[model samples]
Target: MSKKKLLVYGSIILSMLFWSFSFVWVKIVYLIYNPITTVLLRLIISSILLFIIGKGIKKLQPIKKKDRMQLLLLAFFEPFLYFMGESFGLQLVSSTLGAVIVSTIPLFSPIAAYIFYREKIGIMGLVGILISILGVSVIIFNKNLNLIASPTGIALMFLAVAAAVGYSVVLKNMAAKYNPITLISYQNLLGIALFLPWFFLFDFHDFIYAKPNIKVWIALLELAIFASSLAFILFTYGINHIGITKTNIFINAIPVFTAIFAYFVLDEILTFQKMAGIFIVICGLFLSQAKLNFFRK
Candidate 1:
């Protein structure tokens, strides 16, 4: 492979690693801060960091007036709704489980494309979707086929998945015009605007009164720098260099990273059922992206 290709892949992998660690970091932050406060503070820090980066690079393109509405909506789906779902969901479930659920974002993106843009899904993609659903069931259900985790948490994580798909759908329209950094910076800024009110109404008092320890502050800084700012930049660069589908394929690795980190860092159990489910989910993700003529060479 060419050097540029290698760089793109490396960036994507690093992005996933940062994101995987975010699951653990969120768990850490929740020990001291409520979900709303945690997300609000992270976005605040991230937005400022992104602004500095954008200014330093001299590539921060201004959005046209007509496109501002679409940009606002994009922010709503992502750093706003997506964070709301994932951060709160992590509060109730294991980080590993939350990562597993979030990994399914790519599985359904083709369907979202089909629905929103009239794109067609291959037969293999449909089959992969079914298999992935089965994998999800295996993860969620126990030996007795009863749900093993919090239903509300699973639902919230799915909400994050849906918001992610929506973000991609909208992003495809605007990416050609704006650079990745510009998009992320503006979206994060708008998301801060959207979430700050909720944070004040619900979480501001706790944030003001509670004395977070050093570790909590450290986790917050990592979330702002690595997960929210740098990771988004790398992931968006992947989407810009590659297409969204290919970039999304790399997202499947997040659960693996999260599982390992959660095991060591959070002492979360790596159960047989979870491992089996993760393997099946990854297989389905690969199959979903499989081409029709693979052996032609």
Candidate 2:
């Protein structure tokens, strides 16, 4: 692979890693903060940090008047609706389970991508997605093949998956026009605006009364800086370089990363089945990215 290809893959993988860590971080934040409060504060902090860094580096692009509505819609699908589902869902599910559910974004994103951009996945890509989803199923299901997670949590996480699919469709239209930093900075800013009323109405009092210690505060910061800010920026870069279908397929790796993190941080058990599933997930990721010409050769 060339340097550019390497960079795109690196950025996407790093974004997945950051997002996987987010599941763990949000769990820590939930020990004291409510979902609304956590997401609101996360957006606020990320927006501020992104703007400061973007401006200091002179990389922030001005939003064109024509694109304002599109950007707002993008933010609505993502940091607004997406966080609402993910934050609440994580409250009721294990971090690994939550990540696994969110990782299903690839399964749904292709339809949206094709409808919006005429982006089509080849045979290899389709097979890879199926294999990876099967791997995800292996990780989530018990030996009896029954899912034991909360139904509400599963539904909420699927809500996040839908929001993410919408976000990618909108993002595909915008990524070519904006740099990652500018896009994510504006995204978080708009997300904050969208979430503000809900925050005040539901979680304001809780936010005031919540006394988070150093550890919780640190986790919140990590969520804001790495997951909210940097992950979105990197993901935007991936979408700009590769189409949405390919970019989203990387999401399957989140479960693997989350499982490892959950084991260490949250003391979640990592069974042999989960490890085998992780290996399968990695194989599927590689298969999705492999060039068909190589297979023919």
Candidate 3:
């Protein structure tokens, strides 16, 4: 593979590692702070880091007339609407169930891509998607799934995933006009601004009294610095370099990594069902990348 391919692929892997461990942190965060507070702190820290990185360069100026609607839409879905929906859903649904639902994102990305952009998924791509979803399902859900996660909450979470998929689909179109660092910085800032009213109205006072401990602070920083800012940049780079189908396969590893981290760090049990799920997902992930024609050499 060429240097560009190597860089993009490597970046995707690193982003996966960062995101993988974040699952553990997410649970830890919920223990102390409300989900909105946790999410807000993350966005705040992340926006600060991006701002620091882009200090010398001029920031993305006033949103362009043409781009304003699109940018607002991106912020609403990815950061504002998506986070609120997922966080609320977690309160109602099992985390495992939620993971299974979120993992479906990869399955859905291709469909979204195909319907909107006229992208085609070959036979291998379809197989990979199905296997990954099956694997995720096996790991996350067993006999006890309650379909009654408030219809509104469920709709919001699914919408969040859809919105993220939208971001991936449209990201390439905007990356050309602005610096990646500047663009992400502005995006996060925009998200922060969008949620400012919600934050103050709901979470501002809570975090003030919550006095998040050092562990909480560390976890939040990890969320902000690595997962939110750095990982997002890497994610965008990979998508731009490799296309969405290939870049999103990295999510296939999240279930396995999340389980392992939960086991070691959080002491979440690795039950037979969980193990089965991991095994299934890994198999699917491996299968997803098996393009035989590429290996004929």
Off by over 4 Å in 2: 123-146, 276-297
Task: Flag the better candidate by TM-score, 2 or 3.
Answer: 2
Model 1 lDDT tens row, 1-297: 999999999999999999999999999999899998898889889989888978998989989999999999999998999998998899888998899888988888877877887776666777787888888888899889899989999999999999999999998888877988899899989998999889889998888888899999999999999998989888888888887888999889989999999999999999899999999888888888876532221
Q: Let me know the TM-score candidate 1 reaches against the reference structure.
A: 0.96
The TM-scores, one per candidate, come to: 0.96, 0.89, 0.83
lDDT of 2 by residue, 1-297 (tens): 999999999999999999999999999999999998999899999999998999899999989999999999999999999998998898888898788778768766765766666665556656777887787677767889888677788789989989999998889889989999998999999999898999899999888888999999999999999999989989999989887768877887788889989999999998888788777766766666554432221
**lDDT, model 1, position 176:** 74
User: Model 1 clash pairs?
Assistant: none
lDDT of 3 by residue, 240-297 (tens): 7777778887877666676677778977767787677667656665565555432111
Off by over 4 Å in 1: 292-297
lDDT of each: 0.89, 0.85, 0.71
- How are the candidates ranked when ordered by TM-score, highest leading? 1, 2, 3
Best by the TM-score measure = 1
How many clashes (backbone N, Cα, C below 3 Å) per candidate?
A: 0, 0, 2
